[model samples]
Target chain A: MNAQFRRRIASAALIIGFFVAWELLCLAFNVKDIVLPRPSQIIVTLIERIPAIWPHAVQTLYTTLVGFALGIAFGVLIGVVIGSSRLAYDVAYPLLVGFSSIPKVAVVPIFVLWFGAGTVPAVLTAMILCIFPIVVNVATGLATTEPELEDVMRALKASKLDILLNVGLPRTMPYFFASLKVAVTQAFVGTVIAETVASNRGIGNLMMIASSSFDVPLVFAGLLILAALGVALYVIFSFIEMRVTGWARRKDEFALG
Target chain B: MLAPPSAPPHAETYVALERVTHTYGRDDRQVKALDETNLKIDKGDFIALVGPSGCGKSTILKLVTGLLTASSGYVFVAGREVGAEPVRVGIAFQNPTLLPWLTLRDNVMLPLKIVPPFRQEYHAKRRTEFRDRVDALLDQVGLGGFGSKYPWQLSGGMMQRASLCRALVHEPQLLMLDEPFGALDQFTREELWAIMQELWIAHRPTVLLVTHDLKEAAYLANRICVMQARPGRIIDDTIVLFPRPRTIAISFDPRFVALTQRLRELIVVASPPKDSNP
Candidate 1:
């Protein structure tokens, strides 16, 4: 326990050292505050602008969560359908690839035109950006179930649904959780980009306003908050991943270490 | 009025293969896996298939299980022609293939949940009974108290034992094994042979085992069918008159050695002759 504590302390010190060096470099270079604010200035600005930034932060969070959820739902549904049938995969995969190739941020104007400027456009942008990972991961997972196991199921005279539920779903869960982590990150990025282009609300909009006024510290504060939010969401999903895939972890521990 | 009295079920063949041919790939480049293969299996017979590699031994197991349809001929199981219809067949593979997400008990209980009659009644009435049967089978395979563990928690031998228990849990009339113990060490493989013999003695499921081990073939089977390489056809159908309740110690018996040597010679002859110089 003491050793673990010391290790954590060392990690924290390393992070603190990094921040101190960054601040010192900015000061030594006599950089204009608008160009690159020090860490201390960013923190102070964060505290001062809390009331102005809070609502926008909340809006960004809401849009990201809703879009991320929708993305996962639709992606999993379509992915499973395509993965189950060769004909569906052949017909839909080319179209999916074509659509995914379009820069998601470029569609923000179209989405704003379609849904009007509010949470809807931001959410749609996030959904479009995040859905691909879930679909591809789920399709690959479903397609790659062990043939030997399938044969065993077949010999037992199991129905198609039975094989899917009992074998396919359980095996694909690890892949699903892994892809979800990537998708959630993309969801946050989509929300920010969407808000930057067209919104009176959200952290991205706040950053835009700060940039126009040359309030560099305030812009940095907004970026810091977004980073924190992204990190927090990622950590939460990672915890869920650990819980869902506890069996795999245990097996790995036994096999490797 | 009923038709004339039918033949007794015991006298009727339980599984039959007639002029079965399986060809892989398309025309011109097609390779025959099985050619005009014919065999009959009685209700409670224990049969072993032995051959050189690429001899389609595993294909025969697949054909009987209806996992693959024959290219030309008819196959029957329990007096019914093979099609999409469900039959009572249990199978174990070279790899254990247990569902990693499920506990050992749940893995074993998979068939009971899926196969009908049992499936319809599974959630009701027979829940505890089913659990008890799984536990009993686990104990029979020396896996008692390990059912709560996951497949990855078990060793290779233990996992294979669990797989056998899983295959037998539904008590199907036919059991097919494709080199089930081939992946284990020699010691573990021999141990499982005894366990399998005891299990077969207690529950006489008609079994078809595909193996490359001559000693394994001689020790466990009542009859061993040897097939030629590639366009495989049965080259030798030898019966082992070994007594029941045979143990691994039988490997030391002179007769066992003679039987194994005879099988090895047949396999060598059946294989494309290798030009080896002393």
Candidate 2:
């Protein structure tokens, strides 16, 4: 097999080996179910309870996706405004920095108060958590375009609008993709935080209920499911990123490899 | 210096700067970049401007191209005063500056997409024709089958060669080069110079080149114009008497050696010293 295939196999082996070691250690020590659950116990709980867990998992995914989509739309619009001109950058950037510095978790309570503690608050929280990165990344991409490149474009009688269309927008793709990865994870956190604080459904609420009822294995199972969801979504976006910004990656492949 | 003959009969100037002065900054911080600089280049004349760093040689290029307006005096290109409208001018710098996201062919075709008569019908009837033209230009520049490749896949020399084709693909009447081959090794630089000469001889575009290398300026330019440091102005304009189709062996000619050395001394004297007399 090639190096890439070998790498995939190695990672799979490492993961399986870690879980097997954990199961063996728990069996050897006869750990209590309530005190320390084994990997086998968590897996058993996950498989048996997946039907019950599916709805809550869907709820969390829905909230996160809606919030993330809105965040990206508004984020790119506002980012282009901030990035296009020196005056706009000066006026809007400091305000964005000040606004983004407010902890997104702290905003969850405010959103709950306004939207009455359902999916609305969860989505708003996720949006608040995720939008900052998109705005920051997009603005930075436009702002950092090389002046000499602009010189080359301008010499050909290309208007500012033409240059932005031809050069600035395409240049922002790699930066936009990078922020999407960071923001997707943050969106999950925001949804969970909102759900745990007030909602009656979703993974965060299910885990909360399990923990309160002293069902430690079920709670661990919920955690594992949420993690898998996050990883799956991250991998999807990473694959898309490679396809969309293949040129950007080619320049870095040699240096990084 | 002996008295020079009057203006090139009937003032046959394709590009001219009449007592042009340029200053940067505002109020007390204002600094003089070019002071009463005057130059006139005939149609299809290849002129090399050599000077010390910060001597405003580039300022002249910007002025003629209308990228920067002069503080005082007139700037004319192709018998008209340059203003907001961009005249037919192409430029290449030291760095290749090719867009990384584009294929070499697409990068070369940028002007056709955004510029005037071509921009309006860029996709209409001539799309295939324009694509073929860029492919031919790339092939001419020794990048024959590499038009499909991204810029980063090429070597530094190859990238610079692509840059030259990109600059000229639009069929500009005036070509401005700002140390276009300054970053390459000796062999590559000389090879590019030969390629540049071939292109120039083919079309006879009005060319203005800014360089720090005296020999490069002497070798490629029809007339060499030396400038003084800061508050820059031309100090010497000498015609090269060598015949066309110049080969690499011509560097050994007595006259070529004399011209390079003479221009070198003029630039050395023009270089700004920390303790020069005010």
Candidate 3:
């Protein structure tokens, strides 16, 4: 426990040092606030714009969460189906790859036209951007199950569903969680981009308004909030991943032990 | 020294392979894995297959376990054809192959969770009883306190022991081993051989082991079937007269040495000469 405390303190010090260096660099250069606002100035703007920024933050969060959930649901469902069936994989793989290759941001206007402004377009855009990683990761996990283990299941007369439930699903959970970590962050970015183009609400819109008004410090504050939110969401998902893969954690502990 | 026991009366054949042949690939690029092989294993018999690489020894084991069907021939388990019927056959490989995401207890219970009669009652009332059974098997294999651990946490030997417990947890009638101890160091391998011998004596499951080690074959098997190289055919079917319960000390015995030498000679004779080496 003492060692862990020391490590935490060390990490906090490192983070503080990084921010201090950034502030010092800006001060030493005597850079303009519009180019790179000092940490102190950014904090002041954050405090002043709290009322304006909070609602937009909430809007972005809503769209991001909804899009992320939908992406995971559809991605895992399609991934499992395609992964489990060779025929499905053959049919769907090229199409998924082709769709994924198209620039997601370029389709934002089309999504805006379809869903109109506000949360729906933003959420749909986020979903389109986030689903691919989950599908690819989950599909690979399900498909690469050990042949020897499969034989064991067959020898035991396990049905296809039994194999999927008992072996396939549990095995794929780690991969799914890993992809979720990536997808959630992508969802945040996607929501922000969608809002920048189409929505009147959200942090992206707030940043855009600040930029046009030349409120550089407020723009920096909005960017900081988005970064903080992304990191927080990522940390939350990582915690959930650790819980879901408890068996793997125990195994790792044993190996280290 | 104790005298060897006589063979039990009224031994019944448990597995019979009649003129089994397996050919891989198609007409122009074909390779015969097993060539018209015929063998019978009586109940409680411990048989080992030894040969050079690509000798179809592992192929035979796969065929008996119904993992791979013979191209032309019939495999019978317990006097019934094993084509469509699922027989009670346990298997262990060179790698432990325990699922890394499951606890040792869960891994051992996997077959039970999948296999019927146990699967039906597994979720409700039998949880405690099932756990106890898993505990017993783990105890038998010297892994009593490690049930909550995962595969990656264990050493190679421990993982292999867990795998052995998993294979036998359901009390399978036949155990198929494909070079199960091939990856271990010398001492661990010999130690496992003793453990395996004890397990076989206690359980009396009909075992078919495929190995490249002549000494392993001589130590454990009632019969050692040596196979020739690719498009592999059985070259020798010699019965081991060595007494059991065999120990690592037996490997140093003069008779064991002579038997190993003979098997080595057969393998040397059976192998095709290399053109580029000399």
Best by TM-score: 1
Instruction: Give a tens-digit lDDT track for model 1, residues A73-100.
Output: 9999988987776688778889989988
Which runs in model 1 stand beyond 4 Å of their true positions? A1-11, A86-91, A251-257, B1-11, B125-127, B273-278
Considering just the first chain, candidate 1 attains a TM-score of 0.91
Candidate 3: clashing residue pairs, number? 0
Model 1: what is its DockQ? Answer: 0.63
Worst 10 residues of 3 chain B by lDDT: B1-10
* C-alpha RMSD of candidate 2: 3.6
In candidate 1 chain A, what residue range of length 10 has the lowest lDDT sum? Answer: A248-257
What residue pairs clash in candidate 3, if any at all?
none
The recovered share of true contacts, given per candidate in order, is: 0.81, 0.69, 0.61
Candidate 2, residue A50: the lDDT equals 90
Report the CAPRI category for model 1: medium
Q: Model 3 segments beyond 4 Å from truth?
A: A1-14, A21-36, A85-91, A246-257, B1-10, B275-278
Per-prediction DockQ scores?
A: 0.63, 0.53, 0.48
lDDT of 3 by residue, B183-210 (tens): 9999888888988988888888999999
